[model samples]
Target: MSGRSDKKGEMMMVQADTRIVDVIRQMQEQRKQDRQIFYDIYSQQEKRQDPEKKDTGLFFFRGEKKAPFAVVCAGGGFYYVGSVHESFPHALELSRQGYNAFALQYRTGGAEVACEDLAAAISFIFSHAQELGVSTDCYSLWGGSAGARMAAYLGSYGPARFGGDDLPGPGAVIMQYTGHTDYTENDPPTYACVGENDGIANWRTMEERIENLDAAGIRTEFHHYPDLQHGFGLGIGTSAEGWINDAIAFWQAQIDES
Candidate 1:
């Protein structure tokens, strides 16, 4: 098993053409086998009766006791199909780095419950810090695109605050190509590159929220791949290795600092 001090971190390769629905099903099986931790935390409308369903299948990865444990969220637009290969790979990589890493297949959508799921996931991880061999007090949220949006939302408004004297939330948050927010000069070049796809024109209602999070002192880091589109950081297509390396570097810095 790769670990923090080890040169080779945990690695995952998101397979091509895998759909989100299947991912959800696979996770369900894992849950049944009792090999998984944390809850799926979705709703009825998101499941049966709706005919067509979209669920963020959750995955958990544990590691040695350490600060800045990770709650990784993968970017699936308000609807990122579960790219387990893209998502869990990163979590496993981080775990091997010796931090408790969780790849949350959070409920996707603008539902109020979905938002709750995000908060609940972090709270759940922290809720059981000891079993995972870490302190719940310190953790970081890492996500891309849709996952990034949710992470930023939770990071900004979810809880990770410092107001109530020892606020309950992750100490760090990172965005690979977070959509669903306005642009800023400090945004990564990728953001500028995806003008039409992830452009400022893309989000109008949530700009204020993004700004508010900044104002609240949330440690937000935005990375834009000027040439890569929305899911650039997902380690898909031709850039999987580079994406993983970039993610490893990004995550390692956060973990060590955490």
Candidate 2:
């Protein structure tokens, strides 16, 4: 289905990229191969305790068993989740690169709640790493826009700060097109990209954050694509094309160092 046709409420900046359809087809192929694609991060009891969690889950894209994993969170300005346009395609691509990937379906309406869900999701994956055939080591977090803020916050402060387990932060954090300005000396290695023409998220803010990270002695990679705007997922046919590969390389470099 086209992203335009599948658009839901309050979801702005939805990209009409063909990668969405390709990812959906790949999901079907995975299912046909008897793979379980969707998993609930919250148990039935947890959902019953807080009904808001009923809308949250994870969509798995398998690669090599025991490979490092990444969690991709979609941008929706903290009001909704644009996973179809943002996260799923990225996860599919990551899986093809032989890394286990999960697209998060997080509860929206606010950033705090959403980040709490993210922390919980990370805790769940770590708890079930053996069963899921994933390596907890060198895992990464990927997100766009508001989702970028979520990943950055978690990367800076950790899951324990968000009421989850006292897990170590990701090896790397990949963020796209966000104005988040918070960071610390302890943050994970970060890779950030934004379009020069992105009005909603001023590229300068992103640059400033990267500058701060670098000043703090944290490794960072930043890219500002000319003439592109916000939410340009995968940046296909644009100057931002092939950026994900660069981010993956950055993540791999961190893994190697670890």
Candidate 3:
């Protein structure tokens, strides 16, 4: 909410209950700086094989150069990319807190395809870390709902498990409002949150996932906010509003450990 005051009028266009897609469209329409909001991740030849690939890109909200970076994937239920609500807002907040953040826009065919895009995106960032002014030494992966599933899958299985190049797992994983419970032994430390009343992404399931991760000896932190709903990005004004800062601290602790 650091810079939201400047965009108060534009932000008032959407309410807490607004659908994520509508909110994203409104944000995109009100965007003033185009250069800060768009980035292409695939080459023309790659897009030629799948026209949807042309839409795939990464919108970066940069923080301190050479700091550990985060790749954020937004939730769209495998039907759309909710970059405006889930991606950009989270990335903006993380950047404000001095963490390099990238909001990924990937093909939306299904979880598998989206995960492949995420893996490739991570590989691309690592390959160009020096030029991008980001450090590959201790990056994190963050996601919401379906995107959380992607993040968890990548953290547990590594990028090579998907179709992308073989790469080291992220140092940490941050998930929000996801029902995905699958995990592998010794997965990356995780920080998760979900609204108690969220119908789409069950908070109970998330709790169970956390318990399981803890039982497996993976470091875990979770928060269940009272009376909140799904897709509450950065949880502004809600009980979960400050959870991003907490997640950042958790990620930093992992970096320190590494």
Cα-based lDDT for every prediction: 0.51, 0.91, 0.85
lDDT of 2 at 21: 71
RMSD of each: 9.7, 4.7, 5.9
How well is each residue in 32-101 modelled by candidate 3, as lDDT tens digits?
5443456677778988988888888887777898888999999999999887778877787787788888
What TM-score, over all chains together, does every model reach? 0.59, 0.93, 0.87
* Candidate 2 Cα RMSD after full superposition onto the native fold (Å): 4.7
Q: How many backbone clashes does candidate 3 have?
A: 0
- Counting clashing residue pairs in each candidate, in order, gives 12, 0, 0
- Candidate 2 matches the true fold with a TM-score of 0.93
- Which is superior by lDDT, 1 or 2? 2
Instruction: Give the Cα error of residue 137 in candidate 1, in Å.
Output: 3.5
Q: Which stretches of candidate 3 lie over 4 Å from their true place?
A: 1-37
Clashes of 1: 12
lDDT against true structure, model 3: 0.85
For 1-258, candidate 1 gives per-residue lDDT tens digits of: 336313211221223333344446545765788765554533566466542334543566656765457767765555643446446656766666667777776555553444455676666555556665666654667776666665555654544331112245445556554445543333321111121234532432334434655665543333333222345444444333355455455545554565
| CA displacement after TM-score superposition, residue 233 of candidate 3 (Å) | 1.0
Off by over 4 Å in 2: 1-17
